[model samples]
Structures are given as structure tokens and as C-alpha cells.
Target: MVMTKRQIFVVFMVLVLLVALVCASHVTINEEEEADRILQLPGQPKVSFQQYSGYVTVNHVAGRALFYWLTEADHNPLSKPLVIWLNGGPGCSSVAYGASEEIGPFRINNTASGLYYNKFSWNTVANLLFLETPAGVGFSYSNQSSDLFNSGDRRTAKDSLEFLLRWLDRFPRYNQREVYITGESYAGHYVPQLAKEIMMYNKHSKHPINLKGIMVGNAVTDNYYDNLGTVTYWWSHAMISDKTYRQLINTCDFTHQKESNECDSVYSYAMDQEFGNIDQYNIYAPPCNKSDGSKATRQTMRLPHRPHQTFRQMSGYDPCTEKYAEIYYNRPDVQKALHANITKIPYKWTACSEVLNRNWKDTDVSILPIYREMIAGGLRIWVFSGDVDSVVPVTATRYSLAQLKLETKIPWYPWYVKKQVGGWTEVYEGLTFATVRGAGHEVPLFKPRAALLLFKSFIRGEPLPKS
Candidate 1:
């Protein structure tokens, strides 16, 4: 039907108003992002890339907020994918380990006096987003005191999803960007759970997250297999005697909700008497010398009745590196620059929260079920283990993956980087398994170049270099 001149003018006016509204919305989101941008971090060297950090309130009623640092890709950031990284402790800060020491661009110096550029930072290939998740870890916090003690896997995943949805709203430019979730240790639980939440949300939401895949290193998968694998790794690597191994196997019932006294005795004896002073996270690396005199005591000690508690605390490369993060992040200037701790949190910033770790209310005994679900859902899944990690050792990952009973797609073979063998990889029907040679629990810290190569391959959906 033909419109009258007046009707046409009204339609034109509505179109003009819609365009104006879109422009205004875009400008507001950009302004919010700019407000959160990092002008300059106190000891950092000038660089070409942009960075932004701030908090996204996940639970307004609970006054819970999570902190995040986004290091944009070094070049052509708009063309790159966004990768979110988390570190597992049930309570570790991604800023402390993943950002400062592993895949992020800056490395904190020994004295915490300065920062240096890492040539192998993962930001080269994607925009790296590091999140200090769940309230009470790192700069993340809650006004409600009980939130700290009540956190667990389910709550953590829910809060992370809320954070991402809110964060995407604040940075609308990245609303449709392809996203990948990566982490280690307990993040094995975090990454998949968050992805599942996103997948489920996408089915009903107006704007769905473009989640591509996930990769986890030295992950905590199954309690029974991980515990069995840890004991076997220690024995095979000669960290403990054959007799001690047999004793642990006989007494430890990983399936039991509680640790038997006999199991505790054997485990403690194995660590204190049998295992030497070497770092369990990286058996070949020397223990942290700069650690407070308590390192030895803490290393040998195991928390009672908590599955994976001992290993969770021990997951790091330079044991004292966390000390540096503590020093750097706790600086008042650093807090001001990152726009963190605006609430004047009462406690000092720590790498991991003991309260959360100790009181975490629920943990899935096995993540394999989620793995099968994700794999069947057509998500790209890659699991890598650092061979030298005695805590959640390669053996543990192998045992856990074996339970999936997947058909092999590619025979096991060495994958190379820079003319040297970086790792061994074997592809299954839907999952990929790889081992980083001579690497520890924190693989990137131990083998940055290889880690970057692996990340590139994962993002490109290419196999690791066979040459």
C-alpha cells in the first residue's frame, strides 16, 4: 500500500530515532570500557597493546564482585578471538599465576620492583582475559562474610557466567567475538561447567556467547583415578619406595568421603619421610628458597579428608612466585591503577584463599561425565599434562582419560616445536590428549614456547606440528 506523505515522514522520523538510539548505546558502552582502561601500571614498561581491568558485580544482593584483567591481542585485536583464563585452587587467583607468570604479557620481577615483557605471551594470538573468580579470591570479594566460606564448584560456575554476561554488556564490541575458555587444575571443573552453562543459556537467550572450545592442563578430573595415578606416578618416578606405594594403595580409599587414619598416616609418611625436599609440583625444579621458613612444613603436610587439597596448594612453578604476585597486587598504587579493591577489603591480597579451599561445600567426584557431555555436544576438547608434575601428574590425567574409553583417531606421536620434541599427542574420537615434555604443573611457566605453540594449534584447529 502507498503511504501518505505525512505517514512517510513519521516512518522516516522513527528510523532516524532508531539510528540515534543505536549510536548512543554504542558510545555509552565504549565510554564504560574506556573508563576501565589501564592508563599505566606502576612498574610496567610501555607497550603497544591496550589493557583494561575492573570489577563486574555478579551478585548485587550478596554484594559479590569478580575482578578481571583483559590484555588485548598485540596486533589486530579486533580480528582476534577472546580467551578467558582461570587458575584452579578451588581458590587460586588467575592474576597471580595465569596472568603474571604464565600466559599473560608481563612477568613480575624477583623484587616485585618492575615488570618485563614475555615474548611468548598468549595475547599474541588472542585477547587474553584473566579473571579472579568467585568472591573472596584475589581482588574479587563479597560484602557478605559468609560467601567466602560457602563457595564451591556450582556457585563458582554460576557467578562466572553472570560475570561474563555482565562483562559482555559493558564491552559490547566483543559481544559476538569467538571465545575460548582455558585453565588448569581445578579449573578443569570451572571451564567445562561454565561452557555447559553458556551452551544451555544460548538455547534461550537473545544474545548467545560464541564459545569455541576449551583446554586444561594437569587437570583434576576423577578423584579415584587421580589419587591412584598420583600414587603410581610417585612410585614410577622413584619419589617413593615400592613398599610405600604398596602401603598407600592398600590403605587409601579414594572413593570414601573421609580419609581413614591409616590412609592419612601412609600419605603423610610418603610425603614427609619418603618424598625428598623437591617441589612436588615440579619434581625436577628446586624448592623455592625464598619461601618463608614454612614451605617445607606446608609441602609435607596434607589437609585431612579433603580430596585434592594438598595438590591444589602445591600447583605452581617457582613456589615463591606467588609471593611476588602478593607483593605486586597488594600495592596501593597497583590497586588504584587496576581499579581493584575499591571497597577497601579488610584482608591483604593472597594468591589463594584458604577459607574457600577449606570450606568449599560441594565438588563433583568426577568431571568425566561433563567431559562426555561436552564432547558429544561437539566442543573442541584438549587435555594436556606436564610430565614432571607429581601432584596432578601426567599419570593421573592418563588414567582419568582412559575411563572415557574413546576410540583413537590419531596414533600417539611426538609433536615438535622449534625442531625439538615439545610433547606427545594422541587424538581420540572427540578429545585430544597431550603431554608437555620436561614441563611441570604450570606448563607455561616451565615451557612457554611449547605452550604458546600448543595454544596456537588449538585455536587454529590444527594438529600439533608432527615435524
Candidate 2:
């Protein structure tokens, strides 16, 4: 084999190009060094800093990058539990829920008015940390905008782990503090996986994570159970009809090997109950639109984007509604809290829809197995649910808890806060199953008072406030 001058040159050029492409694909990596973020909430309870703005460099698909200006907790260092809050949607930002709606220093006054102080903020008892993770959420950005899309559970957990490492490095004091991971919805997947990873690393790493317990609300831990639970939740809420319920059982076998017409029928029924409009129903309940050229649907469903918002117009925007949060987040003070350089990227606090234009591989991990592992290793496991949620019902959480088969050293009982019964708690199978009384899927939002109480007790290793 003889190598000609021209061929060799061509081969060399191709190799150079390949290397250049690889470099260009990952040019935006970075880490933080002694940075501070500040926020101010006008007319809210006075604190040294009304907002929390900090930076942590993360290595993801885009290499080194900084996630900037997530909200912080009020100083209660003595009893402050290091709490991490996560928002679901698989692509949703925790900054939206943790800061704007639930237990942040401020609350959105959706009437285009201004910000309001949340008297029941969780920070009063714990040091909360809200993160916009995976290097593409909220203030978090990468040199590669393409990094914004195509994300999955494994990547999310890894990226979050990096953020934790960096965060702990910056705030080393909390390394040995009680760390509790809590989130809602899709976080059902995120929190459990992250906790498992932390627990695993702690077992063998030179620098172990002082991992404590985790809590999820209206969480989606088991896809199969969750899908069926959706039907059950809706039925319990009286959101669907008896006829439709019967149709689901008769036609759809939840355990069937394949998707069937019966399943389609059940889905359609649920959709009709949710949103009456064919256009609106497609967003979340697409399977329920199949009906005979029938009379008008039972009742036109509200737009999925902000149905709960409209439903709670007279009351406060149901913290459950994305609209409620968006309306408040769009306020000027809220923007100040963000501290993002919008010139670098467009920051829309509330996305137009839930479907994220991203791609990523799905991993198979079970919370029950992870729970058992953590328990075996002497790590605490807490599973909390909002009783009123129709999204991830309390029943499903109970089912997940039962699978662990841990002994019931502590009996089920009520816990109290502020002299008012706020929720229930129990110790079973070496895990705690607690409930927040008036919350929805976004437990903190709907039940901040109870949520704060729950967090305080968690950090102190005490029983929850009983109702």
C-alpha cells in the first residue's frame, strides 16, 4: 500500500475537520468561583436578601457551563434544613414553582398588581434551594443552545449530581447537614433517582453525601401504576362519568399486552372530561376525544395550559395552575429575582406548553428498590403526598410504600404545626409516608403552610405536623 501525497493531505484534512467539529459542539463549558446573586421582593417580609442568586458550573452535553441565579431561602441556619425543590414536566424549571408559587420569599399577585409576601414560606424553617438544572433551564444556559433539547432521566440525574457537587463545594458548611430532596410531578422520577445516586455515592466515595430523605407530591414513580391511577384519580374526583368508567373496564385491560381499543375508549373518556374542545384536549388528554357524533360533550373542558388558573380566578390562582405562576413570574420584581442576561437567551418563565422539544434516553429505575437500598444503608426515606391531588393520588404513594415491606416501628398518626392540624405522618418499613392536607400536585403551592411544617420536621428528624 502506497500513500500518495494528495491522499495523505485529504485524510489529514478530514481528521482535522472532525476534531474541530467535536470542539465546536462543546465550546460553552464553565464553572463558578466565589460568585454572589441578590434578589429583592418589594413589600414582602424583610430579609437580608429577598432573592437568592448564585452560580454553579455544570458539565453536560455542552461541557462546562454556569447555571445562574436560582432562588435562595431565608436565613434560619439553626433549624434550616437543606431542602432541594424540583418542578416536573420533565422540562419544567424548579425556579418557577419553588420561588414564585410556593415557599419563596415572594408570591405572585397575578392581577398585574405586584408581589406579595408569603407568610407561610418554608424558608422560615429551612434553607431551600431551587435549581434550574440540565444546563438549559431558566437562568441556567450553555454555549450550545442545542443543549436545550433532548433530555432524559439519566442525564438529568447526572447533571443534577454535578450541580450538587459544585454547590456543596461552594457552600461547604452544609456538606454534613441534613439534605432532603423534594419535588413534584415528573420529579417523582427526578428526586428518587437523584437521591438514590447520592446515597450510592455516599456508600463508597471518599467524600460522602450526607443524604437524608426525599419527598414527592403528585409524583409519577411508576408509569404503569400512574397511568391507571390517572383514571382512578379522575373517578374519585368525579371528573369522569360512570358510563366512561365502565367503558374503560369493559374495553381496556390495564394489564393487557398491547394497547387496545378499550384503552383508547378509556383515554377518550378521560379527555372529554378534562377538556371539551377537540383542539384543547390534544395537549394532555388526547385519547378521550373519540365520541359518536354525539350531543355536546358533558361540559367543555378548560384549556389545559391554565384551566386550574381560571378555575381559581376568584380564589388565588390555584398554585397548581401554570398560569398562576406565570402571571406572577412575569412581574417586574420576579424578573429581578431571575437576574438572567436575557440578551444571551430568551427566558420565558412559563413555557407555552408542557411538551418539551427535547430528546433523551429513558432509564429503568425503581423508587421502591432504591428506597430499600437506602434503608438497608441506614439512610432515611420519606415519601410524602398531597391528599387532595387527583394527579398522583395518595393511594399510589401508599402502594409504592407497601412494596418495600419494611417493619412498622412507628405507628401512623397526625402531626401538627401552628396549633392547627396540617397533615399526617407514619413510619413503616423504615420509611416515612406523610401527607399534606390541602395540596394538589404542586403540594407546596397549594399547601405551603403544611409544606413548611413538613420540611421543618424532616430536617429536625421529628414527626410531621399532625392534623
Candidate 3:
């Protein structure tokens, strides 16, 4: 029980070294986070929440980096769950849609001259993270041009996983925080696919992502079912002529992976002729009128040789909000404020990438398999449809969910918000489906109050309000 002086000195020195290491690690993380913080956005109204934006390099050799914007909860952020939002064109910018117009706290003004508060921002309840995924979307990019040209579902999922892993290291406080993934349109594939990767990674990693659930709106689920449902929606809603509907049903073989000329002709006819100048994403909403006094041009997806390339531009309550996002984000001062486009990307910022959309290498024919796997694993899964969205209508979602054949836990019924019928909901054995009454493709933008209520219910693992 006698300790020598040298032994005591060695133990003292070891303790000092450990403390230094800990302090150094903490300082480094703080510095990295501070470097990405946004002091103030151009013309932004005063706000209490903290905002950060920057890039995480997911591939060094390819020099691929993804941009992200984080809006901490309005109050007591540490107590809030972290929700990541994605927008899917397989090439769309979450920053443009999710942050600028939908769930993020700020909305771009009509003139793009200033920012205004969104009363229904999801950040009121959760820490919101918006990602510009798969380089070539928004401010994200790759030094290897081919990476942009050849991006696909598999690569996108892998890159996004890498981004999350590295991003968590930068913001270690959220490593064990409850996390939920959400998106709309093609992110039907992105959200589920990314969750599957996270689940798989957790199996072997000592530090696992605290992934709790996932929600997607107007999502693309299955090729056959989605296509079948889309045609049916047009016919039922009287957006397309019966002849056009029949042609679409008979010519476009949803089960086939390749596009046929007859299918292409009929599909184009339905959009160009039968659909008129109205916004396809929101059947009842007015289309964006150009400043030059011309009608809004149709922006349909008509890829010649590709399958599952049916995503069109997602619009908002202000049909021209996407245009305003383009004008705002491309500004030098705005980019500087948010620490984006640091590499001086060759192209202007856009809501969606045309090159990536056209050149997307792979598309999943069906995402129901992943749904089944996740449901069996007991993860909270929710799929919501904006009832008025013709692109991915309520009928399409119903058709896709029907393929799952899940027993109904709660029979379909109207869900209320503020004593008004917000939508209809039906809880199944392992999944929850709801529709946002009169909402468009971008539910949050078209029906923000209802969307936020649905989000609150999703994270709470509670049913939509019955009253």
C-alpha cells in the first residue's frame, strides 16, 4: 500500500492528458459549428431561432459535397426531435422547396426582396434539417462531372448515408437525438431507401442513428400502381378526356421498364392537350403566369428511354415560389450569408436540376418491399397524400397501399383540425395513411396548418385528431 513518488507523478500526468484531449475535442466541434452558423439572412425578419448552413463532403475522391440548412427549434431546441426534409425530383433542391417555401421558418416574399416568418413552420416543434442531396442539386456539387451525370437511387442513398454519418460527427449533440426522415414526390424512394441504409448501418456500428420514423407526401411508390392510379385520377377528376385515359391505360404498359413510342405519344397528348394550361401538380390551383403576360408553360416529365421518370416540378400556393427561390438563392449576398456555393458552381441555382433529372441512372420500380421490411422492423411509417395533387394523387397512394394488403387498424374516417375536416385517415396494421384536403403536391406549402398538425401527430406516434 506504499506508493512511490514517480508512480504518483505518472498517474497525475495521464489524467492531465485525458482532460486536454476532451477539451480539445469539444473546442474543435464548437468551432466547426460556429463556422457554419448564419448570423442573419438578407432582408430576413428578426427571429430567435439559430440557423446554420454549409456543406459535408460525402466523397473526397469524387469531391462530392452536399449542402444542408439547419433551423433549430423555435424554443428549447435540445428537447426537440430532429427532422430531415428532402424534396424529390431525384434532382430537386430541398433548400428550394422544403426550406424556402414549406416547412422552414422563413418564406421568400413575392418580390424575393425579403424573408417573412411562416406561422406553420415545422421547426416550431422539431429541429428542421433540409438537405440538397446528390450533388448537382442546388448548391451541392461534385468535382467529377460524371457523378452528376450518372447519379441514381443506389448512389444517392449511399451518399446521403455518408452525409448523415459525417454530419452527426459535426453536430454530435444530435447523434442520439430522435430523428425522422420526411419528403415528398420521388423521395418516396429517397426517404425509405435512406432509412433502410441507416437501419443496416446501425446493425454493425457502435454509434447508431436514433431513427424513429419516416413520412412522405404524394410519394411515388410503385410503377404499375402509381401509373394506374394516375390515369384513374385524371379520369375521375375530369382532367383528361375518356379517350386520353383509355389511350394511357392501353398504351402505357406500367409493368414494363422501357418507354414505348405509343405510350409517349398518348402521354404527351394527355398533358399537352387534355390537361390544358392548369398546374398538373395541383389540379384546382391556378398555374404560374409569366411576367411577360404569357401562360405558364407545361413542365412535364417525358423521358424517352427511362422508366419511373415521371416527376414534374412541384409548385406551391404561390405558383411562382419556385421562381422566387431561384432568384433569391442565386444572389451573391444571399449565398454568402448562408455559406453556400463556396466553390463558385458553374451554374445558377435552380429548384430542380434538368441534367440530373434527365440523366438519373437508376430508378426503383417499387418501394413497397422496403416498406414491408421497415414495417416489420416496427419503425413508424406514414404516407400522406395531398388530395388535389394530380401528379401523385390520393388514388395513386390508395392503390399503392392496397398492394400491401395490411389489415386496417382503424377504418377510414375524417380527421379534423380546428373543428374543420382537414382530411381523411386510416391506420393500418403497421402504417398510417392520411390525405390533406385540397392540398397540392407540396402539402406544407398548400396546406401548412394541416400539414404541421399531421407532423405533430406523426412524431408523437398518435392518430390524427378525431374531432
Candidate 4:
């Protein structure tokens, strides 16, 4: 067929435009993909799922960035829900603890030689995102040193919410996926605060986050209830001496804004008595054999104990996983594979940064009010406690939940796993409370199978298996 010169010219221009569009789309995809891709870790096992680690700048002016590690679901990544897991140190590394140790698809083996598929990995049904939040925690950092000093609850939530929204631009696939924020310890504060931020944003946002629910384990939800329940647990468990208990009752005021001199002295003595030789996170569990010891006892300071050790889930994971993680993360090849420490961080990458913890400011004393608000907003909330965790024990969680005073939707009952009792569960209108039979501060680490069952039931909005 013969065509006129004008027709040929028009066809040529259309083809050029199509090519340009395709090239632009390719650039966008590859830019986001290559920046976060993980080829392989030093000793990681081959996996069907894709994993990514990189920084998302939260504050460009301050050069502050948060690090995230995301592992897609092995079977159907696109269909899986997105779970963003944060570790609670106010200064902890979620990637180091949550991703590498507890609920990640693979737990860094004790020797750090290779990875093995975690039989109970949460990612089996969800895309799990582990974030080392706040500047100066793990590999996340800031150029302005003052940013670290100003870190706290409000700032953390703002930064995290911004990080999530900004992150959506990079991985648009998850922009509309349902988001479930889960964490333990200080994350009790982080998760709810972040969830509240999302809820607030939803009020004004045209493109809102698809926030569905939240889960927290051994969380620090309230100052009064948390402390009241903690001291009561310590005394009831025979952890502190009778005299010390008496002193705690008479001299210590858990409701006090700051500990009095007498309370400080008594509390120090009680802590030393209970936690000196073992893990306070799990009273019955053995101490970490790797680290020297908690900073409380390291010096001769008679001051009250400070928060230390983001080495979480110590009860279920290898007490020495911290040591293995240190060995693995510090390897040059491993960092290169993960695309970490690109700016040549000044210090070695520690699992938890004391600087971040020390510099934290504006942290909430309690998150109870936020919990009330979120629950009233019809957001699903689940609070689970590890029975054996003395730091934030089942007792403390029960006391906190009691404050909600929500009548039981489902009466407390034993939930079974594999024909054996895994734990007891209580359902409330806005919440579900469960206890891992003998798990420690970190439930998944110690009771992986049971933890998985709990998570599965949670996403499905089902009651724990009674039979």
C-alpha cells in the first residue's frame, strides 16, 4: 500500500511519543527499585520473596532519614496486607530486632552463618515492614546532631507518618494496601501515636492511608497503670524483698511525675535485686551472654535505672542473636548488599543507639487517651502480653486493660494451638487482649507458632481458637 508523506510523518511522531512515555515510566520504576533492592546478605539463604533496605529522608533540610527493611509475602505479595513493625526503645531498631530477630521471614541464626525460613513468619500472609525509626537509631541518622536530642513521641509519630506517606510514592503498590502498625515495648507509644496521626491525616487527606488496625505486645500504655501493675507484679512474684516491697508501697509513688529521692534509692535497690543476674525482660530467662551488662550496673552511679538494650524478644530468640547480628551487620559485604551506611556512619552500627535513647524528648508518659480515641473511632485494636515478661508483664497489661472497662464481648477463654493451650484470650468491644502462656517480653521470639496463629486470627478478625 502506498501512503502520502503527511501520513508517514504523523505515524512517525506518534511512535516517538509512545517511546518517550515508555522510557519515562521505565526510569521511574527502576529508580525506586534499584535504590532499595537487596541482592543478598553475607550469609543469607535464597528466598522467593523480594527484600529491600534503604533510607527515606524524613527531613531533607536537616538531613534526617529513617531506614526501612521490607520483605514481601512469599506467595502473593500484591494481595497481602502490609504490617509496619516498630521496635520500642524510643531508640530501638525495628529492622535489627523485629525484622532480623522476631517476626521477619528469616531469623539471623545464632552463628550469623546463614538464614533459615522462620516457620512462623508473619510475612507468610502479610508484607512485613521493619523500620528503624527516629534519627540516630540503628542505621537511620541525621546530619544535624540536635535532631537526635529533640527526638520523642510526638516528633516520632510525625516523622513516621511523613515517612509512610513519602514511602508510598516509591512503592505505589502498597499505597492502597491495608496498613497494620504493630510493635512492642516503647512502641506501645509509637504504634498508637502513629495510628492516631494517620487517623488525623485521613480527616483532611484526599489520598488517605488505608489504616485497618494495630497490635502491641507488652506495651507501655499508661504511667499510672503500667507502674502500679509493674510494682504489684514484682511484689507478687517474689522478685523484690518484703522490706523493699513495703518501701515501694510507703515511699514509692508510681503516680509521681518524678521519683522522689527515697523512691529512686528504693527502686534502684529493687531493680538490682531483681535484674542483676538475669534478663529483666524475662525474669525467669537467662541473661544475655554476649553484652557486658546493662548500663545501670556498669557504673557506680546511684541514680535510677535508665532504658537500655533494644535486644528485645530475648526470651524467644537466641540470647546471643544480638552478638550474631553485630557480627553480621558489621560485615562490609553485608552492609553493601543491604545498601546500608552509604554515608559512612561515624560509629559502628550498634543494634540500639544509646545516643538516641539519651536524647529522646517529649515522650508521652501514657498512651491511654490515644487508645480511647482510636478505639472510639472504630479501629481494631489488639493488645497482647507475654506472661513471663516482668518488664511489662501480663499483670501490668491486665491492669491497663481494666482501666478501659469495656465489657467483655467474649468472655476470657483459653485459646489452643495444635491441640494444646497456647494462651488465654479476652475480647472487648474495641479490643482483644491475649496472653502467650509463658512467653517473655517478645512473644513471637519465644512462641513463634502461637504468635503466628494470633496474628492470623487478628487479620481475619476472628476469635482465638477455643478448641
Best candidate according to TM-score: 3
TM-score of 4: 0.91
Q: How many backbone clashes does candidate 4 have?
A: 2
Return the TM-score for each candidate structure.
0.93, 0.75, 0.96, 0.91
Candidate 2 per-residue lDDT, tens place, 1-467, comes to 99999999999999999998877544422123223445354444456533445556676456545443333455657445578887665566676666676667676554635666777877776677887765565556666655665566787788788889877766666678778888776687778788877876777789887777787666666545554565565666666787776766566654332357657655665765653433221112212222363322212111101122112111244323345556565566655655554444566555322324234346343456666666777766667887765546776677656666677867888777677767777887667778876655556766666787776676677766444
Model 3, residue 317: distance off in Å is: 3.9
Query: What TM-score does model 2 achieve against the real structure?
Result: 0.75
Question: What are the per-model numbers of colliding residue pairs?
Answer: 0, 20, 0, 2
Q: Sort every candidate by TM-score, greatest first.
A: 3, 1, 4, 2
Candidate 3 overall Cα lDDT vs. reference?
0.88
lDDT for residue 241 in candidate 3, whole number 0-100: 90
Q: lDDT tens digits, residues 411-463, model 4?
A: 98999999999999999999999999878887888888999999999999899
Between which residue pairs do clashes occur in model 4? 316-445, 316-446
RMSD of each: 2.9, 12.1, 2.4, 3.6
Off by over 4 Å in 4: 1-26, 274-276, 290-317
Clashes of 3: 0
| Tens-digit per-residue lDDT, 274-389, candidate 3 | 87767777777667778897665433332222222222234335667777888999999999999998999999998888889878888888999999989987899999999988
